[model samples]
Target chain A: MVAPVAVVGALFIVYPLVKLTMDAFTQGDGGFSNFAAVFESAAIRNSLVNTIVMSLVVTVLCVVMGASISWSIARARSAAFKALLWAALLLPFWMGVVVKAYAWSIIFAKNGILNSVLDQAGVIDEPMTLLYTRLAVVVGMTYTMLPYAVLAMNPTMSRFEPEFLNSARSLGSSRTAAMVRVWLPIVAPGLIAAAAIVFAISIGFYVTPVLLGGAETPFMATMIGDDIFAFFNYPRAAASSVLLLVLALVVLGTALKAVGSKALKGGIAG
Target chain B: MTHPPRKLLAAAACALALTASACGSDTDSGSGSDGSVKLTIASWGDPFTSATREHLVKPFTEETGYEVDIVDAPGKFVANLEAQTQANNVEWDLLDSTSGPDAYIAHDRGLIATMPDDVKERLLEELPEDAVTDFGISWSVLGYVGACNAEAVDTCPTDTAGLFDTEEFPGSRTSISTSPLVNLSMAEIANGVTIDELPTHEIDLDRAFETLTEFQDASGAWWSSGDQNLQVFESGEAELGISYSGRAYGLIDSGTPVEVIWQDGLYNPGFWNVTEGSDNPDEAWEFVEWIASHPENAAAWAEALGYSVPNPESFDFIDEKTAKTLADFPENREKLGLMNYAWYVENYEEVNKRWQEFLRG
Candidate 1:
């Protein structure tokens, strides 16, 4: 049974990756010429940088927002608070990533619903041009990614012992200080893990940025997809895919190291 | 140990059920195949395929006893078709594609067979001088025009240049961001160049880029998907969009104050070509010929769709009442201008490279 599963997985996942890596290194009408084209083109370089920067921003935002929201929901005093948090959490689930992006577009577009609403409320004479800005991309991405982040941290947050938090508070620390020191340290692994997950996802994202971002914004996955699917340049697309995979692995490796080191130090101390 | 066997059987059954459910969504019904000549033809959009099946394929199969399978045109179709031809096992009989890349690339690679004699004969009899090319036949005049949000802008922009004029039309604009053709073309028009005088005809990237920047500055969104394009119009997210003729029709039908500007609309054509290694080439040709020339079929297919049939004969049969309801009537066609596909095909890669750099900058 294990052999069969392993064979199937290896054929589907491993074979594609190995093939991609091999294609990345080869050149010509049929070879690695496509990979050469990727590096030669300055546009692809900019797209790569943009993708990394966007991924980092999205990951950091998700980590901070997810931890805070999860904490609120997991430790709420009232059933109403829990219910409200649940409602907030589930709201995004009902709205598709594309639809959520559209909603943001409507709010941000020159004569969008949000602008119209704001104009009706007499907040400003003119509607603010909020759509197609980088801010919109970040906001749209964060909204889509927040659910993943929250789910990742929620289990750890729920299982977290209140005693540890209390002990830190009792030791002459304020609530905010205790959170930064004890609570954050305890949840550090979860945050790192969540960030890694968010980073991997955001790195590979295509639809959100294209819909919400300016023409200048080109993410790696979108670029790769365009290169291969749109332009039909297989080798370059495969090369870019390999590079993206490498970048994802590096991030995952770093996350693992950070978590591993913390655990090692704790083990020695104990 | 008492209930271990029962538990194992139940677990195995549950896993099997889950596996079955996951694979169920993408399965073909095979109702389309009844051991006859199975001709598989693919196109891009869902609406296009539905129209082709209902109006085109159903009639042909009913008349000729051939099984025409209309499938969604995947991006991999061309590459897969090429690979299959090389391996001597071609699957697709007919494929729908744009004139430029589809014709140029596929013909150069020798993946597409010559257009059947009947298709050529019909084209000679019906179409204008410039419509037919060496490799494929032009099927429809696909064009982009200014679709304005009537709610935001009282009057739709009269000319193509108004689309890029931020001061006159100070609202969000939508255009395709992935490919540079539509945006660059609009930009050229914005820069006071007439459709005939566009620098891209000489294939100048710098001039095109300069034009694009002005349009880019005015743009609020760069849409890719059909859904995105339609939503922008319906929800009043944009004041004007460089929208397809079909989408413009849908928006108008929905009672949205959105309107289409026929002036300086950029038009192109799509082709129906047979794969080189197709086993059912005769059947494919029959379907193509029937779909292309059949007036009742083409008119029914074109109505309320994103594409208009390229056949000129189909227009005479369409009643004025129905023609008025359709987006791309003969009167509308006379106003819009089309791009030279032969020119575009020869320089796609070069243009795409420059477009990438222009977007990056």
Candidate 2:
């Protein structure tokens, strides 16, 4: 049974990846020609930079938002309130990524809900440019990624004893100073682990960016799709895919080193 | 050209089963309990294939004894055919409404089969002579035209130059960000290239991109798909923009104050193709011929898809208002420019690379 499961898993996952890597390397004169072509193109390079920047921005946003929500859930006096917070945190599961992206598009559109409300509230004379920009892509991505970040950090936060902070407060440390010294360090591993998860997932995002962001906000995923579908350049697409995969793996491996896999898994599993 | 008669040649071809079998074809056509032959055709899928079924496929099956199996493969003709070619398990007997460029590429790769002479001769009887080629017949016609949210702007630009001139039209604009060819072609028009000169003009990237910058500067949102094109206008995200003529008409029909400008549009068309190694080319040809012979069915099919049929007689069946909105309408056809697909195919690699870069930029 184990043999069968392993074979099937390898066939589905390992086979495609092996084929992709082989295709990436087999282009032109072989052995880095495909990689050279990838580097040679100004568009691919720009998209690579765009992907990293957007993913970093999204990861940061998700980490900040996730930390606050998870903290509230952990510190809430009422057990029922904590459950409700967890339920709200898991609300993203009810909606698909594409649907969420479309919702954001409406929210950001010039005549859409957000703008209309802002205008009615006299926030501005005109609707600000929000849709199809780098900022819009980051917001859409962060919304989708926030839950993962919360899930990763929630476990660590829940396990913490409120008495520890009380003990710090009793030692004449101010509440703000106690949070900076005691609460932050204890949860640092969880934050780092959450960032890794968010960053890794954000790097591979395809639909959210395209739906919420436009051509001006080119991401690596969009270019890879264009190469395969529009130009039918499979080799170039594969090369880019390989590079993206390497980037994600590097991020994950570095996080595994910074916060040991056991601690990261504990934050995820605890 | 007038058609001689409305008789489907496929029925006769099926009656002449020996000749069809003699083409070294698959002996068994996965025949039904009644022992009738079935022909598998690849389609772009709903609502394209849905329209085809309602207008042509069911009628062909009813008139002729052959069954057609539609597999959803929208925008995947070349890719699917290439895969089938490599696997030597060519499944589709026909490809419905394959884009002209895709058909040409597939033909060049020897993935498309030549149409039977009887079917070709019959199709030529009614179809525009130029629409039928060695590989396929042009079945559906579309256009990428200027669209405006009339409620947002006091006046809308009726031509490419007018649309890009932000000061004159004076509204936030949007254009297709996906196709470099469309943006570049429209930009060239803005840069003072005449419509007559546009058919053969190679895009000057430096010149085109400069004007394109001006075009995009006025745009509040750049759209990629038909749905997104409508969303921008519906949500009032964009005031003036590029839109598919079909989608613009749809917006107008749905009570949106969207105006479609046909002047300086791109004449994009889709073709019907018989695939290489087809086990039922005769049946596929018969279906093609049937579409041409029955103009009313063609009109209904085109009506459902918001595309135009090649048959001039089909206009008799279409409503006056909707007929004028189609790409092949006499007035629209006279002014619209078509991209040189052959030219794009030749320079597709370099052009796509630059387009990707420019889009990101």
Candidate 3:
């Protein structure tokens, strides 16, 4: 059984990865020249930086929002309410990313609902510039990835023991102190897992950023896509992909180590 | 519980059945079984597809008794054609390509078939001189013009220079960031080079880049797609932009206060080419010939979609007011610059790299 799975994994996953790695190296003089090209090019460098910055920002926002929602759902008295909350959170994930991005574009357009509403309410004399900006891109990405973050934290939040908080309260600790000292530590692993997942997904976002962002917002995935489709520079695209993969792995590894492997597994499983 | 495993098994079985059925459907829909010849034409999104289907395809089918299937092939036209060629199973009978590097590449790679002699002769006689090529026939021409919001700008600047003239047209502007072909050409035209002189002489790249940099300085955003360009104007993000004439016309039609500056418009023609391995080559040629020969159909298509057909005679069928908005209006045509497709084809890689660098700045 293990052999069958191993064979399938090697054939399906490892083979393609190996091929990509080989292409990245062998395309230009069969060495690390492709990687050098990627680093030296200002466009690629900017895209990489943008990707990291956007992913980090999105990850942070998702973690905070997800944790808040998860805490509420877990602490709710009515099970029906918790189910409804889960349904609401899971709704966006069911829609296609492109569809979601397009929907956001409509909402974020200058004459769109948001501006129309604001203008009607006398918020301002002029319409706000909402579409084709970095803010719009972040909003779209966060909306799409928020569900994942929430779901990741759900199991751990639901399994949280109220007794720990009660015990800390009995010892004359303030509510804030109890949350910071006791409750936070218990949920740290779940938070870490959520952040890691969101970051990993955020870094690879292609459609949302492209649809929502203007010239200032060139993500690494978009650059890679351009290299492959527009420029037909497969080697450079592969090199960029490898670089992004490495960065993602580094971030994930660091998070896993900080959270501890056992705790993360328990958090996810629970 | 044991119930969980049972549910999982049932879901797995359902997924397997769905996958098998999807595969079955693919094979079933691959080809026509009836005796009547069917041809598949790869097309871009609406209103181009809808226009073509309504005015060209339906009429052709009615007249010739051949079934035509319009397949959505936007940015992936070349890739799809290449895949079909590689797989030795060409599904698409005809492809809609721009009469530029794309046609050259297709011709060079033997992906497109040479036009039948009669079809070529008729197309050469009917269409513009540049539109008739060995591999493709020009279907329509879309102009890249300076579009301005009438409500925002007090006096609309009429030339390409006005796009960069911030003080005269003091509002946000945008241009196509993905491709520099139109912008660079327009920049050359802006720097005192006439449309006729552009193809014969080498364009001054340094001067063009300098002018573009000035324009970029004044611009608030850059659009990558036709929809984005329309949105920029429709949403008031941009008061002025270098837009495809069709999109500007769309805004105008939808009651937006937009005006298209015909001066210094860059007219780029899209071509219809029969695929190399087309099973219905004769039928494909007939369809292309019929569409090309019928000026009324071409006019109807042009009227429906805000682009011009290459057949100048089609103007006879088009209304006078709508005809003036098209690229081929004699007065506007004189001012419009034809895209130097050869130059772009030769220097695409270098230009694209430089363009990316420019955008980074």
Clashes of each: 5, 0, 0
Q: What is candidate 3's lDDT per residue for B197-251, written digit by digit as tens?
A: 7765466778989988888777757888888888778777788979988788888
Question: Which residue ranges in model 3 land beyond 4 Å of their true spot?
Answer: A1-22, A26-31, A111-128, A249-270, B1-38, B58-68, B83-91, B97-101, B104-119, B276-286
Of the pair 1 and 3, which is ahead by DockQ?
Answer: 3
Query: In model 2 chain A, which range of ten residues has the least summed lDDT?
Result: A86-95
**What lDDT, from 0 to 1, does candidate 1 have?**
0.70
Displacement of the residue B88 alpha carbon in candidate 1, Å: 5.6
Task: Sum up the clashes in candidate 3.
Answer: 0
lDDT (tens digit, per residue) of candidate 2 on B201-275: 888888988887887778788888878888888877789878888888988987788888888877777888888
lDDT of 1 at A11: 86
Give model 1's clash tally: 5
TM-score of each: 0.85, 0.90, 0.86
lDDT of 1 by residue, A164-254 (tens): 8899888899999988888888877777777887888788877788778755687887778777666767678888888889988888778
**Please, what are the lDDT tens digits per residue for candidate 3 over residues A92-117?**
76666778988987888777889999
- Screening candidate 2 with a backbone cut-off below 3 angstroms (N, C-alpha, C), the clashing residue pairs are none
